[model samples]
Target: MKKEEKSKPKKMKWNALVLSFLILLIILVLPPFAGLPVAGQRALAVLAFAIMLWVTEAVTYPVSAAFIIALLTFLIGLSPPLHGAGGLIGTKTALEWSLSGFSSAAVALVAGALFLSAAMQETGLDKRIALLVLSKVGSTIKGILFGVIIVGILLALFIPSPTARVGAMIPIILGMVSAFGLQKESRLSALLILATANTATIWSIGIKTATPQNMVGLNFIEKAFPYHISWLKWFLAAAPWSLIMSIVLYFVLMLVMRPETKAISTGKDVVKNQLTELGRMSGSQIRLLIIAFGALILWATEDSLHPFDSTTIVLLVVALMLAPGVGVLTWSKVEKLIPWGTIILFAAGISLGTVLLKTNGATWLAKIFFNKFGLNSLSIFTIVAILTAFAILIHIGFASATSLASTLIPVVIAFVQGMDNPGTIHGMGIVLITQFAIGFGFILPVNAPQNMLAYGTGTFETKDFIKIGVILTVIGYALFILFSLTYWKWIELLP
Candidate 1:
């Protein structure tokens, strides 16, 4: 039975691998349609294969990324040049293009952000901050819920990684429950776990550095348009939505998954004990706090108080933290801890998006897809309604928001660019709006890493999660459209 159980996954993986390659072959062998340039068609084939691999978990992401680069090199290189005097683009030029993502400011920012997350982890600053906030929220259920939300928000600001923030909170929440002698499957456990995960998801919108999905969208926009959404600009435009959603999260969790008790009574004691175990703040924690706050200031005032972009600011922070005397972390200590595969996957995703633009693959796709649905004739309001629904629905199949953004943003950019400008409609604005919808991973445990983390605790049944998620999704969708038509329009973030 054990052997069979293991073999099932192996069989499934093999099936997915075959299907992905079959897709690539079928697309490649198909004659160019809709005037898709040879290079563009090849790029699409590579993209489809990568998407299948990503969605199916047929192979590890870094392995998939390596496969993508190799395919792009050969497939695109063998195709005719994109423009002017054509022979072959050649593997040399194609290889250079394939590797271009590593040089992008967006990719660099992600790498720097990972380094910062590692620093926080190594210094235990993230845990101390979370515990400190929880310790202050008192012993009531309401206060604990509020503290969970606040901790998520605070961490989103200081720690750039969504998974890392949630990671820091999960064990603490679990430990608090254990310390209080609460059942692992108790309502309070479910409520706290869900609250922690959902809070992390919600705040990913308000802060630019909170998630790599934002970076993915920003990357596509910068590659295709002159507009640059500074950290402040993004926060100003999106924070209100996140703030409103945060409130909704608290109430919805309270209503749908009300805990059995009004208060843990021992909540404060448990938190205090945990804080005591952490002991006094170390020198490393103090230095890390100073650096984190400094970075926050620089991020908020970007492009206004200084010309340094978010990427530059992040790189600087990383450099400062890694410096000999001035920094808190050593390269030798954190080197193995850093997720190098994620960096590779991020860079490869960027490269794929860029190639789609360079070869006009995205443009061709946008035309076929939107025209088939008659979306061009719809009002901007109606168009957003449809697009956001599509974005949310599509997210159900993707575990990584970064992959979702990579696959969706380029096509969205192409679609918006092809629309009637009307002076008010900008691809960047529509893309930003759609990116918000992409963050709606509320409905399923597999939808996000945080959700999966919460699910692994066994505190909530799948049915319970779905019930609450349905409500949150509906409310969130309604809020998304409302914001798009109201605040986003007033701020000129939408048409």
Candidate 2:
């Protein structure tokens, strides 16, 4: 009884980690016992273990990735259908399969985009763009909020990172709001901060490369469906809805949190003063602007004007950003700025997803769950509505969008392919829908990094965030259905 009391506190202290660890041990036994094929069983163990670790965060993101590599190599290394031999697979072949994620072009695109996002920070180009937009939006409080949304959507295109954009813009927005004599506790301040976070989050959908999760989704889609999404192609399909969603966010905020004052006459002056202090654009800033637009033009036109893929274009852009004298940043500056840990885990996620599909693990899991939900007979629209709503709502438990995606997307693909005949469903629009819905998981600060940053500003209560975020998520859901019925149908991505 004394020993039990002592262990109770210890187990309570770890929350889900210890429990998840035990569950993992039990999960590894199920596949073989349940008569799953050897490779599929091994793959199932890896997928279950990875999802548990990701959700519990018992291990750091990169450590979870390392666990994935090590676990796969150990469990399925010698499974049947050897890669290069007549019998069991060799260590070399197993190692190659385990590490195949590093070879993905999508992985490279993410790494290069991170470097480019770092360049914006290195050159203060993001700040320049924010200031430039704020200066143009005029003195009205409404216009300033609109300008922030404009910057969010626009920056999301070239930056390819919502967190980076949030880090650069939050301080500036808060400072300007303070300069306007708006108190931090004021409804206006909370609304503006929430607006910025929601706008940035929404942009993740419209631009495929804007967040690593979107890229992860595309990678999963390519594996499951035949259609490939291009940079311009994604923009045309989802961008308009982002604009409409941001506008909806703005009005929703106004209706819910009526500001203390209707207008801030000093707001324009505040932004103009900041720009004046910045003086004329520096040489590095100018060079960065040129490169930024150069990359944008290429990204938007790559499908037609250039034969190279999006990853190749991003690689070229990063090269120009680090080119000795002409470059805006150096190796020393960018090396520390890039989040290599994120890159490691994201790369591992692609590999994990690939393993799930190749080994039939994803399909098997899909069958089990689809059977439980009776989704097999539901219409495509009904399934999508349910799936998208579930995706958005499920974000409440996740603290990282990328991790949520790495875990959810494989299951989503399986669900889509679960119908009586896979031919009965088009399978094209589901990925796009998943991309849009997943980004709207803002019911709490833990839902996404942008929300966490915005929450840190201390302008809003958790209750207020939940109240506003849930409404916006619902609105975002409706927009997804509307776009599916209209824009996506016109584009032939959906029947």
Candidate 3:
């Protein structure tokens, strides 16, 4: 039985890889349709190949990214250039375009953010902060649950990576469960763990740097539109929606997955003991806190207070944190902590999206999509509802919010650009709102890395996750519409 289980994954990968190659061949060979340029047709084919590989888990992300870059170099290079006096883009120039995403400031910010997450982990600061928050919340189950959300919110501000924030909290939360003498699978355990996972997702909606997907959205927005979304401006527009959803999360989880007891009488003591085990805060922790806090201020005041952008600020923070005699982490230690595969995949995704836009593939596809749905004739409110629903439903198949955002945001930008709205409907607003829906990975453990991290604790069943997840998804969708009609419109995010 164990042998069969091991072989199953190998078989699945072979099948998926075979299917991906077949799809790529068909698209490349099929006669052009929709008046798509030769380069555009080839770009769409590569995109379909990527989506299939990504959705099916046919290969590791960095491996798949390497495949994508290679294919783009050859396929796009062989096709006629989109413009200019050239027979073909040529493999040399095509490779350059394929690697262009590495040059983006978004890529730099993501790398810097990863370094910060590493520092938090290396110095054990993330764990200390989480335990400190729980220690102060008292022993009541309700208080602990609320504290989990609070921890998520606070960490999202300081830690830019969602997985790292949730990663830090999971062990501490499980410790609290053990301290209370509850079984790992107890209702109380499930409740607290689920809340921790959901809170991480909830707070990510508000903070621009909390997740990579938000950066993916910003990348597309900056490339396709004439707008620049400052950090403060993003907070002003999206934070209220996230705040309301955070409240909704508390109520829904409380009602659906009520714990066996109202209080963990020893919860506070366990947390206190854990905090005591660490003794006093170290110099490393204090220095990291100050540096992170200063960086946060710079990010929040990007456009208003000074001229430095968020990416530049993060780079500077990372440099300071790694400098000799002044930093919390060394290069060798931090390098292992960072997921270079994710960075490679991130850069590849940006390059693919840029190619889609540059070749007009996204525009052509968007036109067909809008016309098929008759969205072009609908009110902006109706359009938002339809698009947001599409975003939510499609998330079921995506394991990475970053992949979803990269694959779809470019098309969404093109969709908005093709519309007739001049000023009233801001493409940035529509893209931003849609980006929020892309974070709705509540339906399954496989929907996100954080969800999977929590699920691996074995404190909750799949059915339990599904039940609470369904509720969260519905609430998230409803809240999305509510904000669209009221706050989003008042703030000029919608029509």
> 327-446, model 2: which lDDT tens digit per residue?
888888888999898889887887777777766677777777665779878877677777788788777777677777776788778777766663523575775677667877668877
lDDT scores for all predictions?
A: 0.87, 0.79, 0.87
lDDT of 2 at 271: 93
Those runs of model 3 whose alpha carbons end farther than 4 Å from true positions after fitting are 83-86, 422-425
Model 2 deviation from native, Cα RMSD in Å: 3.7
Q: Rank the candidates by lDDT, best first.
A: 1, 3, 2
Give model 3's clash tally.
Answer: 0
Q: Using alpha carbons, what is the TM-score of model 1?
A: 0.98
Cα error, candidate 3, residue 453 (Å):
1.0
> Model 2 residue 31 lDDT?
39
Instruction: Compute the lDDT of residue 304 as modeled in candidate 3.
Output: 89
lDDT of 3 at 97: 78
User: What TM-score, computed on C-alpha atoms, does each candidate reach?
Assistant: 0.98, 0.92, 0.98
Clashing pairs in 3: none
Off by over 4 Å in 2: 1-15, 31-35, 78-91, 415-425
Q: Once model 2 is optimally superposed onto the true structure by TM-score, how far is the C-alpha of residue 10 displaced, in angstroms?
A: 10
